[model samples]
Target: MISKNFYYQLITRVLGIVVTAIVMAFFFLKEYNALGIVVAIALIIQTSLLIQFTNNTNRKIAHFFNSIKNEDFTLRFPENLDIKSLRELNSSLNMLNSMIQKVYLKNEAQEKYYQEIIKQANIGILTLNKKGHILFVNPMMENLLNYKPLNHINQLAQVSEELHRFFSNIEPFENKLFQFSNEREKVQLSIKSTSVMLNKEELLLVVAQDIHKELDKNETDSWIRLIKVLTHEIMNTITPITSISASISKFFKVGDSIKPINELTENQIKSTSKGLDVIKEQGENLMDFVQSYRTFLSVPNPDKEPISALKLLDNVRLLLESSNTNITIKTIVKPFDLEIFADEKLINQVLINLIKNAFQALENRDTGGVITLLAGINENHTKYIQVIDNGSGISEEVMSEIFIPFFTTKNKGSGIGLSLSKHIMRLHGGSIIVVSNDIETKFTLLF
Candidate 1:
């Protein structure tokens, strides 16, 4: 309808101009010089009016667009114009501008909301361009660094030179730990970086968290667990020694004084000898336990080399099978050539430990126990080996203590296997994790 109205107005104006020119020509041809001059003047006025009318709409549209480009929504075109086409055009533009303004306001509000969230976040967040220009740094980040108004990565030198170097050389999609001392306290930051594209510009989005408290808590928890296990193991050995020593002492002592040798019975002497032997055995066991603990604490750095995952799994399967084959053993290596750069010996120890645990978990099952030795790359493109078992799975209560040294449910278990495995993985810059249910258990060694 608006188009029709606009075309009608345009056609009418053109017809008027054509008719005025024709009339002016006729007057001139008839030799009516004064009338011809008057008609020619009127024709010029009509043509000027038509040009102005078209330019008016064009100017309004251009101005509206310019206002939008500059993010200014204050420009309002008059809707009470004499022409219907002009009035309708003005109203439609006003409506469109109003809608766009509302959307702009909404988006602005949302951006502000997100910015507020970032500002109040507990963890530190910062974005840097390739030139190290800090695009955005939240208040939490400033607080964490103990330096405000952080405008560039180089400004990290104001906090610590080492921190500046860390930021400068940080790699994307990797986690790094940085420790530095400020005036207030020692800060242990767990930092991670990733690439983010904003407005067609690539930025390094780095998130840093003050993990000092968490690390302290974890250290304290680990100490407590170690103490508990140590106390339990030591007391087990010590209590027996104490009891046997007490019993043997009674054979020779009378009211805290040594009895005469002639008064000692043969059975008493034999009992004393047996008690001494028992004490010696317990002392040896205690020494071995301490030695194991020492070994756990002294895990050497990995001698890394590329080792085929399939070969590793197969070797472990063969080693475990040579002793017992009651449980069905299976090997799975994805892509047939997946490999890991790690100490082959240390990795073998970890795999053996996990596979043994799987064997133990399935030992009680009568007929259908299955242990799967799975080797592959995980979703993160990290190499991993899984020892999965279809058996009575590990209970949650036992699972929590499985990684603690000398904490075990088995009667004869020294409880060093899983903990040692975890330590070896840690040395290799890897990790071990376990998941279990009533029907199955899986231990994954990630590198």
Candidate 2:
């Protein structure tokens, strides 16, 4: 309607000018000089009015766009005007401006909401561009690092030079542990990074947490578990020896007085010899258990080298296949050329232990027992080897204690294989994890 009215107004002005020009020509031809002069002046005034009218509308539109470009939604055109078309145009511009303002305000509020969440988060949050200029640093980050108003990655040096270097050289999707001393106390931070694109520019979003307390808690928990296992094993070995020794002592005594050797029967003598032998056996077993514990604590550093993942899996498969003909073993190495930088000997030991566990898990299966050795690069581009078995999976009650030394569900065996595997992976600066369900169990060695 506004457009139609504007066009109509424009046509009327043009037609009026044309008609006035025709009248002036008629008057001039008739030699009516005064009327011709009056019509000529009237034509000039009409032409000026038409140009001014169009220019006014164009200028108003230009002003509205300029205000929008400047993000100044307050520029509202006056809606009251003599011309209906101009009035409607002004009302439309005002409505558009109001709508835009609402949208802008809504966006601002949402941005603030997210910013507040980041600010209040427990973990440290930071973003930096490739140039090392810090884009954002949440309050938690400031509190964690004991630095405020961080403007650049270089500013991290104020907290710790090592931390600064770690951030500067950090790669995407990399995780690292860093320790530093602040005014308050020593802190250990577990930091991770990922690449993010914002506003068409690449940035590194770093998340960090003060894991000092968590690490301490884990260490304490590990000690408790170790103590529990050690105590249980020691008590198991010592209890029988103690009971046997007491019984043998009673055999040699009469009413708390030593019995003469001549007064003792042949039966007592035989019993004494048997009890001594049993005590010696238990003592030897206890010594072996302690030695194993020592070995678990003293896992040697890995002799790192590139080992073909395919060959590693195949070697393990061959070693275990001969012992178990009823079970099927499968090896899968993605990209066949994929390799891991680790000690072949140590890694082989870990794999063998895991495979043995898998074998045991599948032992009860009557048919279709399968143990799969899968090696490849994971989503984070980290090298990984997985031992998977289709069997009755580890129960939830046993899962948590699986990695603790001397904790085993099996009736026979010292139960240190999984624990030793975990130690080896940790020594190699990697980790071992397990996931199990009713159908399958997967143990992953990540490097």
**Using Cα atoms with residue i matched to residue i, what is each candidate's TM-score against the true structure?**
0.80, 0.79
For 1-447, candidate 1 gives per-residue lDDT tens digits of 677888999999999999999999999999999999999999999999999988987898899999999999998888898889988988999999999999999999999999999999999999999999998999989988999899998888988999889999988898988899988899999999999989899999999999998888998998899899889899999999999998998888899799999999999989998999999999999988888889888888898998898898888888887666678889999979888899998888888888777777777777787889888876878878889999788888888889998888887768899999998988888899999998888898888
Instruction: Write the residue-wise lDDT of candidate 2 on 137-230 in tens digits.
Output: 9999988888899999898898889878988899899998888887789988999999999989999999999998888899999889978988
The per-prediction tally of clashing pairs is 0, 0
Q: Which stretches of candidate 2 lie over 4 Å from their true place?
A: 1-5, 18-33, 59-84, 87-91, 127-135, 149-180, 187-207, 211-214, 243-256, 259-281, 298-300, 304-307, 337-341, 378-381
Error at 344, model 1, angstroms: 4.0
The lowest-lDDT stretch of 10 consecutive residues in candidate 2 is 406-415
Q: What TM-score number comes out for model 1?
A: 0.80
- The candidate that achieves the highest lDDT relative to the unseen native structure: 2
Cα deviation in Å at residue 38, candidate 1?
Answer: 3.8
